[model samples]
Target chain A: MSGTFIGMPAFSPPTLPAFSPPTLPAFPTAAKEAVRNPTLRRNLRYATHTIRAKRAAAVSELDDWAALREAGRQIKDHTLRHLDRYLLQLEESVTAAGGVVHWAADADEANRIVTGLVKATGESEVVKVKSMATQEIGLNEALAAEGIHAYETDLAELIVQLGRDRPSHILVPAIHRNRGEIRDIFTHEMSEWGRPAPEGLSDTPAELAEAARLHLREKFLRAKVGISGANFMVAETGTLAVFESEGNGRMCLTLPETLISVVGIEKLVPTWRDLEVFLQTLPRSSTAERMNPYTSMWTGTTDDDGPRTFHLVLLDNGRTDTLADRVGRQALRCIRCSACLNVCPVYERAGGHAYGSVYPGPIGAILSPQLRGTASDIDASLPYASSLCGACYEVCPVAIDIPEVLVHLRERVVEGGPAVRQGAKVTLRPARGHAAERAAMRAARWTFRHPGALRAGQRLASGTRRLVPRTLPGPGRAWSATRDLPKLPPEPFREWWRRTHRPGGQAPADRQEDQR
Target chain B: MSSRDVILGRVRRALADVPDDDTPYEVAVQRGYRRAHGERSIGETVDLLAENLADYRALVHRTDAARLPGLLARLLAGRGARSVLVPPGLPADWLAGELPTRVADDAELTPHQLDRVDSVITGCAVAIAETGTIVLDAGPDQGRRRITLVPDHHICVVRVPGQVVSSVPEALGRLDPARPLTWISGPSATSDIELDRVEGVHGPRTLEVVLTSED
Candidate 1:
């Protein structure tokens, strides 16, 4: 039965290139390169530290932050548990509100639906509002394939697109690029797109922002179609909300005649009232503001205001597969606040590029493996990308225990058990190249079963304590390179225990000596 | 099967682990968060709104119903706005005195035209004190969303202690979800560059909020 389902044309993975380029190296390899770049490290450090301090200050002002965080988590969990019912309700509500609803099972389907929608409108260009879902599906590239241009209107996204770079951070896609780099990108690349940067553009953020404003304003006024990814979709009212710091979102949302929004199915909240919790938590956790500069909420298409024609594409991609894991489903609770990214030590060092997915930092470590499955080298290595520091869990507004999920994913990688892939249940073989670790674990398990063998091994190790090298000879050298191998004692603990204590009830060593 | 059915089927199968007697929505989620953060008087709430709006670099002014027109005139002239977009339902008396070229918001007023207008004036549906947010619901007083968005300067009039709420939750209760809502906290700002915030981006670069009390 499963084979027949997989045989269907629609269920097959699309021929389009993967979201992350296949040539990208695994986490460790990429991270090694990223750490060597001093400029990248400095940029990540400066951005993360500034946001972290402000985030702390902003969160401190909310007295009921714990309650709000718990509520946000519970709401998301409840919504996911009964997502089917809410999705159907959402479809009904949206349709009744004069909007069209389309469902896409994966990225290809989503891109196709959006492309068809844009084509039907006779539009060759569309303005975008920094949507991660669209980025995840590589919608811009897909549209470009069809001879349509998708312009990224967000300042950070504009910089990334102009530089021909992949987004390295969630909130600020160009966080890896400093102001000087941004100025250079703008000065060089602005003309090809539409407007040229003013003569002698400086490196100040304000001036750069003004240049973007002047360049994008003409596009906004002329844009006939706008594509966006909603931050939250309310099932009860079919209301979609987008929270953004810049007015680019507003420009795209309001100026266009036709609006196409591709939203992940997991981005739903059960009721309109549930927004209060997220509205309070997301901004503080994300941009560390009491509220972002703008939040646009529309139930559907209105008669003479905003977009006259609205199309909502509900995208599953790998969300259903992600929801299948009892432990891993918590990743779906993410608000894409990127709070975890800002707080992650590993992310700060490795940078967002190493995660090799649209989502980076600790969240990506757990989410990428589940959504894409740990079949590839990058996916397999993603589980072990973290030190399990648990800072991502600490800053998560939804209270997703990221460390727990990372450890769980690590188990998945090593054990290779029953899992879902592209809506099919498949048994996974243990990831390749873990045979050595597996063998070592099996040997350790054997040694612990027999006390005599364990004692013999311990004695042999202690007898040769002086001869044990400072670092292991071959595979373990890398592990010990930056770490100090502990010095083994002259006597093992078992031998010391046997010599010092009586089997029967007796005070051990120092106490007995004191009594005597 | 349609992709909707396919996706929904997948969702049900994925959630097969959920027991038939799983907790319902009402009890499953605990909403213990406060309706409002701290207790404040109505006057104090309005004051916080003004303070916070200003904190984000929005220009805030206080006046009564009788003086509102004079204040609006002064504000537009001070900004040197050549033309102001007015929602059709905005109170005429508010702009009764000297004003810029009054551009009425109508279907013919395209986004490009709104861009040419120097400023826009509208009345808000609700004002959130904690976040310094003003919500527009395309009400009679508040025109189409684009009018406020396309122009660089926005002068919003808020009824003191009436439209103002202490928190987001309080504001939501008063808002209708069916209508489109645009919540403006401050003039457009961005923190994308090195996470350092700089004001005046795409939206209205200048937002002058007038708090009017009937008196």
Candidate 2:
């Protein structure tokens, strides 16, 4: 692996853009809103279950899938450990291949770099392939601010852009909206963007697809610049790869005079050899295909073949901070297959919109906070969005332990310490919400550590079990109201164990591991 | 900052933090990962592919070359397809028999015209038996990428034993890595949120594989 090269711009502090999208409700509120939409829930339930079954069947066919998953995990972990070396190698190789490599520290910096690149092209409008990295940095918004327009070429993405909607799923950005809603979005909004919907555009799949195809066809042929994200970056060869079901990506990549790819640094694999694992895992895990229909790979620019000028923006945006933590770094292993999202029960119910990022689902629960930080109310609320059912873990092609990371992030949030800023190592001040929980936990921790105090406290609690309120007071009341607090036994387990076993008699088998 | 610069900076910093030694890459083990996690071998990998293909509702056939052309013609005839779209560079012998078909050149046809074609036939670049994937580059025989997309039925020919690979690393060695590669395991399909499986949302609806073994 190589390290970062290209004289890329650094991220300045994030400036809250004037035109922020509808503020994502705090997790509970958004989730509640999502649950009430019966049509959306039905769509989610149907889609997730069917994909889950196919994925299980597909995975069951591979006796070595477990091994493949482990290999993917290990390779990613190893790469992340020495990410700098690989990034440099990547930069040198890409540059040597006639591709310019740019470095972006955060979303703002990344957007600025991309906007500047477009401005330099002297093109006010660019065609875009569905890229998560670009969305993360709010590049489209930034470009618009600089008087540049980005036309989305992907069908679902076109629907999203036309409707002025935020993507709710990684693979299917418009997964939250149904066919009827899509028909309305296209018919009412398509003309404003470019071509209008055909006369009598119905809610049928064919009509909707036709409307989008016509809408995007114009953008693909006329655009002078293309923007994209890669599925994988081969470090040794400096090749960038994109896998898609539609042929739209191929057009955007090949048609434009100048092509810009803004990729997350974690997208790299050491060699083209590493691509095999992801190519297989990505299609199968995401769309439940043995392989994707279109897997487009380009190395810099080719002579009279594709784009003449190729630029790669390798983005960090809190990735380095994410990589520093041993346990949390497992997130980089994600191939963005969306298998975890398909199998995620919470995602099926609450929908992707509730997660409040372009990523959505289980992967988003852990990834967004680490990358964006748990500073804002929405970011802090993401970790608690899961039921920890581990469906996401079971389906992950790259085997990201999403629940583990969610719990880890939750612990960080509840620690009530100062926030961890981008590129900085120090912890900032306690977030207001977690202060009470942190104090309570600290007192409980001190009590648990002292055995004498623990046993006495347990007895007191058991005797007063009836007096305990069914619902907790203050912030906790909402939680206990919906859930049944475990009833206290007649006696604490410690007392029961002591009475059953003689003191110093091997300390009882159940407690042996704890003692060790 | 451009999106490129934002991403590149982070990648630069990430690369800067890791040590320069090649030990990490060198010690990156693939075998132990499989051993500790995967218990199967290459033969089992082949079996997985066959089984998974069948599970996806795709028709899988094992045939010798002498029997392949006849078998494929029969399969097409059964589907009531009058003419099949043949890639310009497809092996002549694959369709040597007397079957009436209109060959579609990937280079000349538009998306609207290709959609009207009944079936498409081409040789695969590589077949990952472990994942049951069929890759096609616009190599000499594969033709343009759109032919595979517009048609509802795709009959991909795979020369078994020769083209098969047990792992992704093995497949990567055979590919150009920079070419426009199309990987197919089965027909293109998607599910609604209600868990209803719908095939042919974008690509071909039915996929048929004729595994030819001349050895």
Candidate 3:
């Protein structure tokens, strides 16, 4: 930790990797650790099933849900196509409403700009609303490097911060954690942060919630600076809306004097009317609520009402890169609802931490590869994480075809191509790890084209069927590790068909019964 | 180049493939979603608001003009509140001859001081029935945003038929976006813990909305 004195030298940054660290173990390896933890598996299963059923019910209530989904998709697509214009318009609107706008090209730039803004405020500590953008950029760790502490005010965020853990889900970051674990975190860690957990804190959720409110209340009341991310920003009005269940968002947004919003450039709606579609879809999809408990909206700063000074930081770490791809741009349309994650069989089995970015699950599988690129093992492995299940696509509020994008990115990975990186187009070599898979695919393609060769190969394999084992060896062992390989038949299908039926032959009785 | 120009240049380049005749916003979106779930009369809308409000655990009270003051007084008395927060332009008779000491909302009352107070009473800007939302725009009756936020108990008076709208779109039409608006469906709540919905976190622990027949 930094020295306690004001003028004293700050210590070197922690040896620990920052939140949502830059690289993670490959998906299969990371997911292995998650699948082994029965507690995490049970927690995710229970939480995901509960929200999934509720979301289906909430969405079913709206007869216009399909139309709303299409509209949400189109509206986001339109805004992105014309983002340069809308962004300038948004800057103008926000400035007109008495706010300043700053632009950051990448994560480090965003961190630099925010750290400078906080230093300028002459404040060393800032209160934070739960923001995925901030988490994505490692802002908290960056601030800590400069001797500033950012207090996470959201209940789930508070649980995460105190536990010194990474968030696993978008809407519910602590979904993998249970009540008992939370009680332990609060009991042990609350005193170091601010107020200690209440005496005899139990595992009851309400009691734990009260303890969090008390612990964070002091920070919220005294916070001179507030940092946040928004759900939607209106270009027409320069209004930013934050949707939250707990009043922690309300406290952080209002109680502070200087407010800094670090938003992705894409969270833009042209007007308040455009907000109606997202307002209806996001809450139901994310939290299964008709309306979240509180939605606090401010146009710049209000007079003595909320923060007096507002700074809007528009971040584009790799968004431009993602947007440049035609097939992959739909990933940008996500509202971060996590419906895709909940419905994903892969996510349920593997959990959120495996995707290794702030974004995880189907959306993450496609998004992380594009946002961070596929050069890394985890990013390259993300596209292959799914079973090509269409469940995630079926539930996305913005109708992002996650499976389609996953396939597109897989193609990009296996075949060398041009992709945008850090705002410039670069030609990428085919990822090193996928070479074996690529050769196997190419060999299969060759065989499919040669029917006579395929028949001969199949007949030879069929002749020696008993020699083959139930499981494969070498690189193929990964496949048969969890599954039994199909046993080859004694005769190839072509020969069986030739023998069973013809102009002068009849269908075999045993084959007919099997077919029936 | 400034990051602004760099980002904008990249965005323009990203969309180089878009045709000159992209779908206009008006034609592009089909917002055929029913404006309101089902058509209901004014009274029915207010009833739906109360039902949904109660559904989310917000206490719903109904009274006409004459009994409104008594109902509010009883609520305050029931909670055993000593210090009550009063917004600037709340109708005088709504809580006339009330028992609690009126701590008027002003600049001097800090959040901590407000937290010390037992309850806050205000009038809402608009109420949406379909979602069971009460919007406080910090208008004359709602005072500053913190007055409603800091106190543990919130009693908002909604003059039914006049203040109630059937849907969110209808409510948005009535609200001015310039104001510091808080849309509250229930007391501050969280489903963060194992996805179990628990009411009362940082905002008022108990929210009591009174739907008065007399506007």
Candidate 4:
């Protein structure tokens, strides 16, 4: 049975258009477009607020939530610190369990390895679970380039694929689309994929979910190869776990003859027991459920149960660069719960597409700049997307200090500094257009060093307080356009302090002393 | 160098700043979380399991060993299921009464064949009360993973007290890591459209969990 792929004949590849990654504008430009769409703003607002309230309630059910969050953080930290040791151990365990482990240094290498594996099986189509890692690497496009079709089986992913749209949210990829939009996508696009939507489909979520169930079932039953990405890979036991609400994850993981899982090296914990912490925190934080509907955990392979041939591709893809910075490395501790996205005020207004990556919201603001490097216009602008309200950090299950990383990335963008890219150490020049800000900062530093210049400047500013405009001219106009400038005090603090506390005058400190 | 060696070298280089006397894994993490939420007796735990399972839209049934077959018959008859998939290790007495056509889970049963079956009945390895989860380890009674998944209706029998745990941590202790385990909270559900959760997608739309105790 292992000689031939099981369940179905080798079908011809479907004729889908080749995917070319889109070049997106910077955060502010994209955000300006997003906020103007009233429909998008309302959709994001309702989804985020609803999930936010439910998540808070789910988390409050457990009194020891803080302890669980800390344990999750420390476990990830400890694993990442000694990652080489744990990865080697994991490789040994998986190999011992009759599975082949492959390592890919970058997205191109990972894609090449996966494509070759699928070609080896002689299968033109593969079923997929909803996986962030696979999306991050653009695996579907890579396979499509090789004449292999990758079918996304998750309900949200199905909507996104059918609509030919990019994923907007981590947990719910099609969060940007309302039920009416989704019904249209399914009704119009489902036939082109495999099965057509039922006649006269309605706009209710239940009917939409039912349509998705029927459309994906045909592909699942006949699938010969399955591809996925795991939530956690236990180093001690060589077990990979995928947490999902839909049954698509189970069908993709179980029915196929060959299963290939592309997982990030950082998605590992030291032992199986560590799952106790994340299992409690992830579901409640992500979907606001006590536990997701289905969580599948499998070690390499068994004789009579699931997939017969198991392959694990451990992907690096710029993770090593993200690990170099001590402060920024905390972003690796993310379990992808996406609680931060729901609570983010900026994400609510600008929406997920504005972030310009598969990961959006506050986590994306920090992670994209680090992993992709702050070289592109979007990557450099991502660091400034947040208001530093710190809501993301508060809702984080692993306690990733996203605000700290965002600020650190801002420093990386403004000042030329040392960074690692593709396993090579390279120094970077400050991003262009920041020269004015940099020069102003330098001049302020110089003036602060000399007390006479600072005092003279303060007096001059105080004397000409009436001359200050309500808004500044030139580049500062955009900064002050939406904000009202604070009024200048009648005199500087030093002058006021000197006048209020003269030797003959009754000082406030003396009055307090007298009262005492 | 091979890609494996290159990636490992990169990881080592990334950690060059780590001190030699760094805290080891044993002392690095603090695990102070509770094993279970609130304390409950075994019976109360099982009752909580029923309540929480129902909360997620799974049908919960309580019956003793003698009446289990009758309850199973009634459920199958109620659903008007023509064919029921049976695992190898399921007790014969559980289906002794007259029922639908039985399809045995075996090598001959393909995924497509399982798709046509109206329902699947099996015993679970362990059930968690706090999260309303039933874990299947592809055990003898549970059969292959595909049997419970492809069918539209699933009737999972859990032996109370012996198979029930209060929380996820406790459930993990009873499960083995080597086997492929599936933890099912309720039937398949999705909150994909506007974050409004709708149960029944791809998986068995009807998840009937029967808690049978041999008193």
Candidate 5:
């Protein structure tokens, strides 16, 4: 638990690290307001339906999509298992190729490393691609604290940054904003950032696109430093690949003099050969295309083409911990296709903002809690966000069993005390409420093991069936308010079976032949 | 510390714990890239290139060297494309009596000028079957990458059977890693957060393939 301890700013208390008890706007209230916005709902419905349909069609074209998904999952799992080895391989390969690599254990170290890198460059401004890793680390805000500016080049990301609004979706960050809202944000906010929007700018797609293009063009041309997060990293040759529809990612990757990529250690695949699976699954899964439009790949740096210097920061904030959990480790296999998000009923209604992290929707629910640790109200609340509908697991390109993981984490949250931060097996303590649940489970376990005790308990419960209340009287009342509590049977199945056919409680399979 | 040293230091430290033994590349990773990427066998790879090209709303046709000129004439006459843009190294007979052909001299014309032409046809460097991918290396017949990108329609003629590979590794082995390789999968597309899809955002909306097999 005690490593370097370098300037790790705690969020609230002395012990808690920065954003440990991660702060979020009261989501229940915000989501209530969001649901009421008719224009937003219309925009979301139109957008999600369109993408979902295209994804389905694109996915359908492949006869072995299921096998492909399994292969993607297996590859990711294998990589995560040997992450330390692959990371070292990537580092050696990159260094040999003249590229630099940095290790960041947590958010503070990551931000400091990147900010220091930019400071060394002597540039106060950097053009950035739409990178979820940067948002996760709050890198832009960290840079802003030091008076450095980070310009967002992606069109959707630009809208979110300009409006000072959080991204509400993964694939399309500005999915929450309508055409009219975007036009207003552009016209009013564009000048402060760079180029001003034209007078009387309309809400048309053409005009809004032009305004964003004009606004970002200058940054792309003049910026000396560029930052990005790669979709995948090749360990064999130390290459990184970024898939983008717009040419903005390509420009940011190529135009700058010094390029810094903050990549998740989980992003590495063993070789370029492994990249093929994702190259196929990722595009069709996320953008619903047979393939991505612009796929820019660079192996370290080269002379007279692309960036002269390249630095890749491999981040493992909580990936190792996540990878240790056998059942929950599959969450790291996510390719960020956002197909699960698109199909999620909860995300569709609540939007991405309510989840309160860079990653939103069903994947976010499981991933956030595991990565950040289930310490805060937000992390605790995220596990319960899903309906356990299993749609996410169904549509996921990697076939991660999201519903199963959600349930497992819920049990861990409800039944155990905080685990030792650095331990082999999470040790459990008997807290009061958890003790009650544990006692009940233990009693049930004992009764099931002993037939005599089981019979007595069943008969006792069956006798009191009429006295059972339809709803609980206290805390359970609140839980039952939104759901139906199952009613007790007049007679236990054991008793019914005993009286009708198996009088001595002999095996039912033996009685079946006698009855015939 | 020197800039190179600083960067390399961080890399070394991060990778400090990795084991010395180098495990073979992840098998599943290679399988992922190869499967459903383009086509399986050489025959299927050619078929996939044809079908995918058609699926991208590209026109496709099959012909032999003996009938190549006649097929070209029929295609050009069918479209009534008065003229076509040909790359500098494109075989003369490929367009023999096809149309009034114009050679694409990269030094003389810009992308804007290339956009004015009705069609630009070239041969691909290699075609991947699993992802329906075609690689362009800016070779003599392939012209500049921008030329293919800017034009309205592209007729890419792939030599059937031989130019196809089942996996990206096979394709990568044949490719010169230093060359500028442009991998084309399908028509360009983008999606909004709500998942609305829009095609032809940047690249061509239509792709055409003419699979020429000697056998």
Candidate 6:
């Protein structure tokens, strides 16, 4: 490859706005750009397509998949319904087992709790398993401010870290990068970290994995502090389960003496037997396997086995607020399988970065707005980021009715209603730019209710059809900008229906032929 | 207010929609999924376990209990393993002294020291047939979790027909939830690179499962 395209921004650190959401543009703007990048689209298409087929086949192996999906849904619903009791039970069980449990209502509190715990350990660096909870809290960023370097051991996460880029996909964070791009990131970025990549690394996957293995081996060997997030936290047994395809999680979880898992409160299930349902579904939904290569489950500190000092941080951030909304609480049931993302048409073309949150795709469309609320442009627009295809709900292991929630959130955004923010209730105003669309919807609702007036209007429009322009003007220009308007029919369909279908009225020629 | 109280209060309030009647755990979830995928004879279950274990790239070997020691010796000699880490409760005859020098599991065996050992031999608490998973619960024969983890290779001897279960639910039934459970399907593998699976990351890259059927 020539040096002509060396400055391609795909591998560079994100140029997003300075502060947290400061630089995140609206979903449409980011998605538009992602749609234009052929490389990103190609990467997303290939990865998503490969996983999607595998997931379908894996799921088909189970004779009772639908039953299992329903069971999963009920179990999560039951857990959420009794979250207060289960959380307390979990805390009690874990504490009884000699593990400390801390609670944080928001990201800052969560980060502070984790940082203080790490400081107590006196470890300057930590190895981390790939967790959406930590990413949501920006724990690494928070720890970095205190002069701590957190090493991400998951191979995709390492690439994102080395490239100094944001994670683009939930599972495969660097899904936007091709093999050649990954090779370049390793060649250029490995030296600054721990171990340098061997000279003249090729684009082969085995070579790339070996480079990451060798590079991260030093970190896993000596690292005293490891951070992770749990896939499921069993309430009755006080067990925390982490399912992973790689052994890196095992290294971080097993090798480290001090392991801190920042788990969301919603991760709890009522009992260990509940795992039977999820373990079967999570692997199939995620990696499309009967089981991931390694699944680590620990309840507090083991005598001579895993982490000696285990701290379970229960992180809320906005989960409580999301849980408050009756319809929106279902987002908490997600297993982070990324099944919805793989099946999402919008996600396939626009990619994950557009969601402007750690979560992306159909789940993100509903989740980001609820977790962060719809006050911002990107968060508000996320509710409108789909074609309502229902592909997401079909593949969701817990059968979260994502389309139902998307429409509900859209109504919340455009109609501006009551919502819970942080921990308090707040009223949201209908976002400013949606006035025209809202007014059009209201007018359509009014006309449909008053049929006589609608017929009169249709007749008037037909009479004046000659004067009507094919293109809309004013507020309607945005709609017509990317699409052509269909021509007005000679007569309204209702009038033709009246002529053809009414018993007293003469049958149309087509109807007469059918009668004959 | 403390973050803990605030979160608990929030959780209580968020769950206000549920009815007052406390639901029992067994009834809340419908466990319609099978304990095992389908009916299989004891011999078939062991065969399925072996088949699934090899599918994930774990090396599967079969031999009668009488010949297991000789087989283990030949296998280690084949690898030229100079040192093998032996758990305290591993059957003494299983090693046969001809394989390599035995580094016994001890309180002083640091991870770095274990790393120097070429292989680890341990017994599994349970093995699942459908998923091809060997669960190590840090039992006497299994030693600590780290012995199997730090070494480059692991040779887990599973007593066929006795230790094998047909499914995950069946396997979990036999395992104590309190103990630290590491359910390993194969050698530590990762799909992190380009979402394509490549085996042999941090965990034992080579996992040799010996299915010893007592004749």
Candidate 5 residue runs with Cα over 4 Å from true position: A1-21, A25-42, A198-207, A417-469, A489-516, B1-170, B176-189, B199-215
Residue A311 lDDT in model 3? 99
Which order, best to worst by DockQ?
A: 4, 1, 3, 6, 2, 5
Residues A1-516, candidate 5: write the lDDT tens digits: 122222111121111112323566434545667778788778777777778888899899777787778888878877866676677798998888778888776677889999999999998779898898888888888887776778887778888887878887778988888788889999987876667898899976656666765576666656689999989888888878888865567667766789999988789888766666777789889988777657767777765445778898877666655665666778988878899888988888888777777788899888887877776667767777888998899899988999999997878777764342322236544334334557667988988999998888878877897887888765556456778778666677777676657556655565454443
User: What are the clash counts of all predictions, listed in order?
Assistant: 0, 50, 0, 0, 20, 1
For every model shown, what is its TM-score relative to the native structure? 0.95, 0.78, 0.96, 0.95, 0.75, 0.94
User: What stretches of model 2 exceed 4 Å from their correct place?
Assistant: A1-23, A198-207, A416-420, A446-467, A488-516, B1-27, B32-134, B140-170, B178-180, B184-215
Best by DockQ: 4
Of models 3 and 5, which has the larger DockQ?
Answer: 3
Q: Which stretches of candidate 3 lie over 4 Å from their true place?
A: A1-23, A497-516
Minimal lDDT window, size 10, model 1 chain A: A6-15
TM-score of chain B of 1: 0.97
Error of 4 at A113 (Å): 0.5
In the order shown, the chain A TM-scores of the predictions are: 0.93, 0.88, 0.94, 0.93, 0.86, 0.92
Candidate 2 lDDT over B1-215, as tens digits, reads 64444344444554454566556565674633331125567557657667766656567888888888888788888788877888777888888765657766744454456657888888888877655677787665767665666566888887877777765566778888556666665665433222234444456667888778757
Residue range A1-516, candidate 4, lDDT tens digits: 121343232453333332222466899999999999999999999999999999999999999999999999989988989999999999999998888999999989999999999999998889999888888888888898887788999998888887878888999988999989999999988876777899999999999888988888989988889999999999999999999988999999999999999999999998999998999999999999999999999999999778999999999988988988878889989899999999999999999888998889999998888888888888889999999999999999999999989988899899979999988999999988577788879999999999889988989987898999999787677778989998776667676666568777656664444323
- Candidate 4, superposed: residue stretches over 4 Å from native: A1-22, A499-516, B21-26
Candidate 1 vs 6: which has more lDDT = 1
Better of 3 and 4 by DockQ: 4
- The residue pairs in collision within model 3 are none
Error of 6 at A117 (Å): 0.9
* Range of the 10 consecutive residues with the lowest summed lDDT in candidate 5 chain A: A8-17
Poorest 10 consecutive residues by lDDT, candidate 6 chain A: A1-10
